[model samples]
Every structure is written in C-alpha cells, then in structure tokens.
Target: MSYQSIHIQIKEMIFSKDVSIVEFQFWLAEVETFLCQQQNFVLVVRSVAGTTFPQEYRQIQANWYKKNKANFFKYCVGLVRIALDQVDQERLNTPALHVAWQVPYYVTLDRADALQWAVQRWLLCNA
Candidate 1:
C-alpha cells in the first residue's frame, strides 16, 4: 500500500500509511520542513500496518531525534497516534511518548478519535 501526507493548514499535518523506513524518512523530512514554519502544530500519525518493533526502526528514530530534538520540540505542540488496536496502540505510543515527553500525546483506536484529539490539541495550542 502507498502512504499519504497532507498539511490541512498551518494548524495540523496528517500522515497515513504503511511505509517502509525509506518512505517514512522521506515523509518525515517533508513534515519537518512544514513544522519549521510554525510556532506549534499538531501532528497526527496513522499507522495502517500492524506494529512491528524492529530494533533498526527504533534506532533510526532515536538517532533522528537526537539530531533534531531541538527543532522538533520547538514546533511540536502535541501528537496524536492512531493504531489499529490496543496492542498496537500501546506498542507504538509507549516509546513515542517516552521520547516526546514535552508534548501531549493522545492514543486512539480509530481515525475519528485521532482527529478529535488532534483538533482539540491544535485549538489549545493556538488559543
């Protein structure tokens, strides 16, 4: 399956896909560029694929964060995670929240919850 990335406005960004590491990195770079223009923005991520905790993937994320943490925190107001089920949600959210503790994170089982949480966060941050 293919991945999609769209900026709904200055308020939010959406990334939905079952992406490979390469695709994820490309999308991430695009998102980062968008975030750089904002004071704060809500980030919504929908992982349509099932969760798989590969060490390589985790390492890549960690390394990317290490290299870009300041820019990341400077613009990220909150995060919304959309997972297929409880197990996937927990598996993805746990580590992500650990790394991005400065931002509020909402984990949801469906797209509607994800969008609701993200919109609320965007409102709060912009307010």
Candidate 2:
C-alpha cells in the first residue's frame, strides 16, 4: 500500500493503526524516516489494541534505534486519547516514542475556549 493513501489517526500528532506485527515494524520505520527527513513536525500515533512493541515489536525497534540513535529524537509526551468501546490496555502500556529533530514553541489553547488560551511561544526558547 502507498504511504500517501494511508491515513494516520491524529489528535495532536498524526497516527496510523498497525494491523499485524510486520506492519507494526514497518510503520515505526516509516515514521522514523519521516522525522529524520523533516525539520519540524509532530507525530500522532494511537496505541493499538495490543502491546505492539513490548510484546511483539520492541526488539525490532531496539535494533533499529541502536544503529540510528543520532538520526532520531525521543520525546515521551505521555498523551493518550481514550475510548470505552476500544483502546487496549496492553497496547497502551507499550512504550511509545515520538521522533523529531526539532520541537516548536507553542501555547496551549483551551478546548472550550481555544483562542483565549492560544499564544505562540518563541522557538528560540525551545531550542
């Protein structure tokens, strides 16, 4: 399947679902490349119904990270969008990593009053 055709889930960052173990590794690898190639961006990933990495795909990622640590940046935002009918706990528990070369300075907009809380921060501060 074409990456262009794929739509990842996005709340803040964009994300996609992994249907299987092989697909899960492929997804991570692709995301890693996207972050390395892009200068500034946020990645959105929804934790799957199972522990994708820790239980199934972590070793693959570990090997990749071991060799390309410099090419990627790890940010643990600890963000989770929960749903009752869905959302697997084991999958959520699996460690999630967001790779980015740079982070942007921004303000938090209140969900109820977006503009009221929205304010842009200086990028220099982030750097």
Candidate 3:
C-alpha cells in the first residue's frame, strides 16, 4: 500500500519524496494499524536523498509516538533509517534522537547496511 510520498511493503516503508503533513498523517495511520496487529516487525524507512519535512511534521510524529509508545515497544523490533544525503545523514546520526525513539534505531547512508541491520534486529526479535 502507498500514500502520497510513502510506499508500504510488508516490513518496510519507503519515503521516496518529500512528505506533506497530510501524507505524514496518512503514513502514521498506516503504522498505527500495523501495530494493532500485534506482530513483531522491523521498520525500515528509506528516504530519498533530498527528502525533508517541516518542523510541524516532526511535532506530529512526536505526539503520535508518545501516545503509542507501549505498542511500538511491543511490536516494533527496531527502526532502520536510510538517508543518503549528507545533511540528513548528520541530522539522523544524533545519539539523543536515537535514544528518544525507544527502539533500536540505526541510521546509514547505504540501503544495504540498513537492510542488514534491520534483518539482524528482526532475527533477534523473532529468535
């Protein structure tokens, strides 16, 4: 399934374009729905090299994550974020932000590394 700038696969979400607030909300809803199934999954978010969002979008995501913290902990094994652009790579490399996610979070410029990290987490969780 797919929203405006987000494409959803069984265990991955690809953000191929810059997302608007509406699109972000849609993606959030899809995530919430997925969590409702109560299954363990690794979420791999691949953002296009230059994709970015406004501060408001971050605020919305923060609020939603806060509200669903427990469900996320129970269902999400980890999160792997692939950001190819230098700016995005630096921004996502923060230790504090990684801790704030409350899940294993990894950021990398290489999609292969992201997938490998995600698969490792998935294996650990499902083991």
Off by over 4 Å in 2: 1-18, 36-38, 48-55, 74-127
Task: Please provide, for model 2 over 12-58, each residue's C-alpha lDDT reduced to its tens digit, 9 standing for 90 to 100.
Answer: 43234435677766666665665565433233334323433436566
Candidate 1 residue pairs that clash: none
The number of the candidate with the highest TM-score is 3
Candidate 1 whole-model C-alpha lDDT, 0 to 1? 0.66
What lDDT does candidate 2 reach at residue 116? 21
TM-score, model 2 to reference: 0.40
Model 2, position 57, has a per-residue lDDT of: 61
Query: Cα lDDT of model 2 overall?
Result: 0.38
Ranking by TM-score: 3, 1, 2
Q: Write the per-residue lDDT of candidate 1 for residues 62-100, one digit (tens) a residue.
A: 777787778777777677767778887788678656566
- Scored by lDDT, the top model is 3
lDDT of 3 by residue, 1-127 (tens): 5655522223677765677888889888888886887777788888665677756997898899989999998888888888767788889879897888888888888888888888788777766
